[model samples]
Target: MFGVLVVRLPEGRLGFLRAFSGMLAGRWDVEGYVPPLFDREARASLEPQGEATVKALFARAEAMRASPELLTLRAAHAEQSARHASEIVALRERHEVRRKQRHARRAELTEAASKSSTPEASAHAAELRDSLHALDQESRGDKAERRRLEATHASERSSLEPKLLRLERRLRALDRLRHMVSRAVMRRIHDTYVITNARGERRLLRSLYERAQPPSGAADCAAPKLLAYAQAHGLRPVALAEFWWGAPPPSGGRVTGAYYAACRDKCGPLLPFMLDGLFVARPRTFTPPSTTPGSLSILFEDRWLVVVAKPHGLLSVPGREASLSDSVLTRLKARYPDATGPLLVHRLDLDTSGLLVAALDARTHSALQRQFVHREVHKRYVAWVDGIVTGEQGRIDFPMRVDLDDRPRQIHDPIHGKPAVTEWRVIERRGDRTRVAFFPLTGRTHQLRVHAAHPLGLGAPIVGDRLYGRDGERLMLHAESLTLLHPGTGERVTFDSPVPF
Candidate 1:
């Protein structure tokens, strides 16, 4: 069996050897790792004054906004706009009230005429109708007079219009100037060629930014920086990986050791150039020869629902590839062909083995899903992480958002992230490894793993978590227990699964 291995190289393309003992053999180099965000050099380089030219550009923009003429123009525009708004509101209200009154009188007269029948009553109604017609003419005349007055008022205030337009034009010009300077500073600071080893094959930073169209601070993330360092050092990227270190940034979602994919909006475009000459392996896609019947463990079942234990490495539902069609739902469907509604109410990560509650009908599925969304469902996971725990128990409150540069992988974003919280209690400590129970209050992607690894949370990456930590046989995380309200009985129900690790 192949075991985990690490190889180090000074620089160059990875070498491959074929037909080795009936298997392909290859010597591959890792894409390279980037130091944590808080690395001393990285932090120092981020100082605002690191580039004097950029600093000066920003200062110049600020100075432009402080000009005397611009300030006067701004104040004058604000006053004129406010005064005009008040006058317009008054004029509109007066006209609207008069129009409504006229319409109401017309309606009342029409209704009375519709009800009249006797000769005398009809004659009187006819007279009243004539009067109403006369009133309608007068109302029309009133509307025309109102419009003329409004037109005159507008003409009287026409002087301010040109001044306002001129002021707007000037303000827009100033804004454009400021924007240009800011863009230049950002380009100088963020768009500089950092990845040197791309064999000059990679696109320039500015070109990448233009193509990717990422958010303001996206290009400066650790992934692209790490790739830049590797290229500069003449290292050929074989495989790339990143991890979170330090306390969760002001926002939350990152765990200390969980592996995360490169961001999409930020790193997606840049990585293609970085990996230009690398021979990366295509991801494997295959189905096992067979699965034993006992592999589909059923903990609880009834007419409406079934709580099945999902084995690790097995998908909860069919994957994108038809070759990966064998899954818990597909297997269950073979046995219970009549099962209706959404078969699975909630899902566990493909790597996480757990007790999954599946609903047999649509109503039951919707009910269970509602409970999950409202945070009424409770979940607990057991994990063995690569660190010793000093704290007895604590809660991790971190905001999480999908990193635009790296898709699927989440990041800590304080300004624009959803709140994620997890509570943990240490089960035991074994030298460098610590076992803990995780109580996730919010269901975010990789919530438990991040909480376990983020410095602010547990400060330890989970053992065997290939994504967040070192590679191993499997991630040492298990969904130990789940608690939810039963869809059928409306009673609180909890299920437990023995931790495999």
Candidate 2:
């Protein structure tokens, strides 16, 4: 990435700081651009020595893997795992026998309680109920014990061996040593990456990432370098922008000189730390959805199925966190307390407002799910995109997968991604923004958003897509319509939701 920060010098002179990410031709300092955010000498010396040591450790480990001493150590580990397995098996068998006895005891108590009528018999039944409670405790204890044993077994497999049980111990030891050396080097390398926020508070690159080691090329981004230079030289930053001016990397597409946002994966966490105390107008401010409804809009309801209008910013289902408990699925469950199976037949993205269908019965859920799997269910989505589309209609076919580093954001990956297909038609031209309709034939997470933003697809991101494009009021994509066959009647039905944006 190439970055420029327009700055006002302390002497009232106008100038701009420029930087490029990472080293250029094995050098951090270029005559014209700003230097890297690191102690130059320390970084220069440490990298080479540390890398050599780590490589040596790997080579040693490889040689040790087939050594005689390593074999003996591996065998010892195997024996311990085997011993643990046998002990657990024996304990399980004993628990099984006790379980059978407990079952017989419960049966006896139940029968006695049912038959008792006299006062003396009733007292005896009460005593037997106490015994049943004790048995319940025993059952719970057995389950707990089983859980502990299973956990230990799993740990042994993970730490000692799993599929490679026959070649263990020494290999792990060597690997651990290599990790220790690498981490120590990384920590020292991290220390040299000294950066100061606008507040004049300096921090190491490692401090910014609390729970994680900084990803490769963390503080080496053009934006971070430019900001650091501006702060050190008593220059007040007026404006900042980054652009690409090189061949695109293998991971994603890029164009030379196209204005780009600071990378989410690399620069996202760092910018917050660097921009402290600056008059950052857009300093990644939170622009929450304009409205949050107290309830869902039901479009259709039958004995076997129900359809809902999912508002943008409302989750299709409740999230794992307690704070995210409100959702269409939760409301649906409350509305249909006796509903069976997984109520949702399909789900929409949290930012997508649309019509979603759900089943009230297991058979209906299965039938509807099968239709979706077979590509029989048709979906239409409408979105306001960032650029003018030349063609009226076209098909976008690509494979996509979640960008693991930056979650929820997907990238095109034909090798590892699931196949996604979307057909689109231009609805109208709205100056800089174009309103378009999308018909996705396959359901992949973020199918419409990625398809709309990808270079090979529209080459224009949806206007309000925060992940793939710039942030706006909310995502402009809406699930405009859905068509599917009714499981109850075996007849076609289509549902439409009002486009709020």
Question: Which one wins on lDDT?
Answer: 2
* Candidate 1 TM-score to native: 0.59
Global CA lDDT computed for model 1: 0.68
Off by over 4 Å in 2: 2-18, 23-32, 37-219, 223-290
- Scored against the true structure, residue 18 in model 1 reaches a CA lDDT of 13
How many Å off is the CA of 122 in candidate 1? 22
lDDT of 2 by residue, 225-257 (tens): 999988998899999998777654444444455
Q: lDDT per residue, candidate 1, 195-234, as tens digits?
A: 4335576454556656434456454555555555555545
- Alpha-carbon shift of residue 438 in model 2 (angstroms): 1.1
The regions of model 1 sitting more than 4 angstroms off are 1-176, 185-294
Sliding window of 10 residues with minimal summed lDDT for model 2:
248-257
Clash number by candidate, in order: 28, 0
